[model samples]
Target: MSKKGKIISLNDFKENRKLTDPDGNPFTGVCVDYYDYEDEQKEYETRYKDGKENGLCTRWYENGQKEYETRYKDGKENGLCT
Candidate 1:
């Protein structure tokens, strides 16, 4: 997937510093997190804006098949999910 947001310093995020999107829209918070089970080869990832899931979230099975995918807007599911 194409990267959608600007990169900011970790320190800024840690300090709860406000940020702006590339287009200069303000964001009160942002975060991305990943979870992996190395032994099982499973993984999951999600992104957040303003303290809520506002982007793609995905999961993968241990066998390498995509387990699921969903999109979010303001922490609520907003598009196709599979």
Candidate 2:
């Protein structure tokens, strides 16, 4: 794994230092992933945050066909498909 800066402390997770995004968006919080760590070829990936799938998600069929494509919001299904 690649190393980033030191964790420092929770104080770094604050907006008091202009640390947030331009939209004043604060912490993105915890995120989880369904990873294909063993495959040499790319495969479907699903990511979750706030206990929901909240980003670009993809799914594939065993026949090597892509089965799902979509976006998410706050971890819920949102837009686009196939």
Candidate 3:
């Protein structure tokens, strides 16, 4: 049988608690959030695995400058962050 999966928006992914991966495991992917209202710029972006942060996580300032960057392993900081 061929593997199948569905791509959903970040909001849907977060709002739905029963989403799963093609393999029947918890879904995993990248999520980017933006500031609300007038400042509609990207606020941050992060990687997720099994519903938890498991890779690179980056945040930005409202002005669009990179505020910080870090790596995560199973939702925990695992490497240098700057």
Which residue pairs in candidate 3 have backbone atoms (N, alpha carbon, C) closer than 3 angstroms, thus clashing?
Answer: none
Candidate numbers, best TM-score first, in rank order: 3, 1, 2
Clashing pairs in 2: none
Ranking by lDDT: 3, 1, 2
lDDT of 1 by residue, 1-82 (tens): 1145455432254535433554445444434333443453547666667645678888876566889999988767889999
Tens digits of lDDT, candidate 2, 1-82: 1013222112242433212223444334332222343552345655444334467877776555777788877655687776
Error of model 3, residue 53, in angstroms: 0.4
Q: Give the higher-TM-score candidate: 1 or 3.
A: 3
lDDT of 3 by residue, 46-66 (tens): 877876677899999888899
Worst 10 residues of 1 by lDDT: 1-10
How far in Å is the alpha carbon of 16 misplaced in model 1? 19
Judge candidate 3 at residue 73 and give its lDDT: 82
